[model samples]
Target: MPGKVVCRDEWLAARKELLDKEKAAVRAAAAFKEQLRNDFPMVKLDKAYTFEDPKGKYTLAGLFQGRKQLIVYHFMLGPDDEAGCSGCSFLTDNLPSSLTHLYAADTTFVLVSRAPVAKIEQYKKRMGWDFPWYSSFGTEFNWDFNVSLDKDVKSPVVYNYKEMEKPFKGELPGLSVFYKEGNDLFHTYSTYARGLDGLLVTNQLLDLTPLGRQDVPWKRHDEYDSKDLKAN
Candidate 1:
């Protein structure tokens, strides 16, 4: 047998109290997000490693200039030959609304990739994206986030996909952050593996579509949708 229950308002009030006081837990989770931000593991981009773009020459740290916090999305783009990944493109589609909020809060968001600046810019134009995109090609930039991928970003042109067609490997989608303090810049967080899971807003929304993310399932993906719960 279970204990007697309280009135609805009492239950709601109790839950709200815990929800409001969860900052310590939130801060602990943020510590995981701030892993790279505090240590600043992102190395400074070298002149030799510089890339030519329609916007002109730029480096890694230069991307976060004049901003308090930098939130970078590791967009899935490889080299010139691969075009781009549709899955990542879908993720990028979910960014604008959030970008507006981040701007209101004074945070900067940009998309980083292993593709050339020219390639990235071209895709942005094609997709009509307004968010800033940068190239991490020809440097340790991609590997730093665990997505630019080793064999492709490193040097080898073969052994991954085509025997001799495509040259470089593509980057997996991810999100990273950085902070600036006067003249110093710190790499705050870099999410890979499941850290990129939060960007799956598109997948979540799709589950609400007529067919849902899974075609065979008879009902909605309640499990995934339940991730976004509020106090009853």
Candidate 2:
């Protein structure tokens, strides 16, 4: 739908009003982030969880790579699936090409999946993703994190810190944050479902437009055809 036509003076007045609200929203978000950093509780991780990547195995603390903080995006690529989730791929596409800024801030970003290292390598090569990716296969990392669901692993599945209404057998997308203090590792935060909306740059940009995202289904970057490239 087209927006209402307005005189330049009227448009300016409306824009100014919206700008005030936008500034207020920004301030509110900053306050919430302050609480996340200063007030949130951290859970000490004692279990020995192992993960494998192209370079071999790594423990949860090993993922920190000498950094004080770690951000892990749980990519939904199960052992039986041939590809990763489209929604997860969408968010991965928005990740920074260089990690220099995060590294400078004593933080590292990585992706974890339930598929084997060999499978992860194949898909990572196909997607041309350079971020550190590891496989939690043969381990309870995914189950413990509440991203992967398997009746055999544990019963009465929970996600977003609540019991799932329906039985699910696959992987779900989520982001988990960890803090490393010397030899100890702590899970500081985790967000699932729509809580991850802030990570998608495209969605954030589209939200500023009148049409917003239009409930469009996301596809992998390579999967978009010529028509999609042209946006026909």
Candidate 3:
């Protein structure tokens, strides 16, 4: 039935029931998110990590600049790649608007990626993003934040390519937080893998989709499903 369609009256009746279940599920998930926030308390950062500014200068305690709370997005830009991840690119786009409220709340937002400063800055300019992006390359920041796996011994294919016995396990995207208390900085919280979930406004809206996120592995324009790893 190429052009077959269900009877109009029957379709409407079925849709109504579907919508009711969808509504309940939405409320439940939102409630679950709220509960997780309270139950899983996040702490402040105690260990300091150095950062390379977009200008190619090195600085530590360098985040949030003059703000009280420091929020760093560990963008997933694999060292082998010449660019940052597209999902991170999307979050960067949102920052222009979020900056107003975030600044007002005394919260500072920035991106921390393993890519070299030169590379990170290049992408920033190309994307027309003015938000702060720093290079955490050759730094322990990534591993400390649990965003990068330990620089473990590489596999055979890696050795055949770069010929280095040991290489970074590569970087994953995440969000880290720190709070300033007088002169000392305390680690408040850190989100890794899919911990950056707050940036997904599309999936938030898609909860209302006819089939929902689980039904369709990928969103409209995206052909990949990185959400699964994060969800796990």
Candidate 4:
């Protein structure tokens, strides 16, 4: 149903009331984000995890790329999968192309998946994405981060800090932040589920519309049908 139509004065009064709540919500969000930066506990990483790119192999520290911090998106592309996850692709679709700002802030952003370098490169080419993507094949990095689940390898599956029944095979999406100090790397923070909503610019835009995302099914950017592309 459409919203009830009202006079300009009444509409302005209602909008102003909402504006006050929006301002309060923004302030609360800022305070929580500040807490994440300063109060979150850090875990020192001792494992010598390795990943591969189109060029060659690189260690965890190498991913920092002279930056003091690294942001890794645990892309849900398993070894047997032919393509990336729709949700992960949606998130990447909204990522900024130029990282000069992140670089200036001493942070490097990259994506990691269990797919091999060849597969990663192929899909990246198809999607026309230029972001750095690394293959975590033959590494326990996915398991360690709880993004890839295996019934045999790990008991009592846990994801997003909740216990789940052991499934034969599964891959989930998540983001992890690491801080580098000299040669030491620390796992600063990680988020999953709705914690990632803030990163999707499309959803933010839709929220301002009458339909508000509509729980729409995600499609790889290039896969949207002509009918779906048409304006409603």
* Range of the 10 consecutive residues with the lowest summed lDDT in candidate 3: 153-162
In model 1, state the lDDT of residue 176. Answer: 72
lDDT of each: 0.64, 0.92, 0.67, 0.93
RMSD of 1: 9.2
Please give the distance, in angstroms, between residue 155's alpha carbon in candidate 2 and its true position after superposition.
Answer: 3.2
TM-scores, all models, native as reference = 0.60, 0.96, 0.66, 0.96
Q: How far is candidate 3 from the true structure (C-alpha RMSD, Å)?
A: 8.5
Candidate 2 Cα errors over 4 Å, as ranges = none
What lDDT would candidate 4 get against the real structure?
0.93
- Relative to the true structure, candidate 2 reaches a TM of 0.96
Worst 10 residues of 4 by lDDT: 161-170
- lDDT by residue (1-232, candidate 3, tens digit) is 2334689998899889989998998899899778755775655546656778746554456575777888888787756777677767665654555488888889888888888887877777777677777888877777666666645532332211233355546666677777776667767666654555567776666655555556443322233467544663
Candidate 2: minimum summed lDDT over ten consecutive residues — where?
A: 223-232
lDDT of 4 by residue, 1-232 (tens): 6588899999999999999999999999999989998897899999999999989999999999999999999999999999999999999998987888999999999999999999999999999999999999999999999899987778788899888854646899999999999889999999998988999999999999877999899999999999999887
Ranking by lDDT: 4, 2, 3, 1
As a whole number from 0 to 100, the lDDT of residue 14 in candidate 3 is 84
Query: TM-score ranking from best to worst?
Result: 4, 2, 3, 1
Model 1: ten consecutive residues of lowest lDDT: 215-224
| Per-residue lDDT of 180 in model 1 | 67
Clash list (residue pairs), candidate 4: none
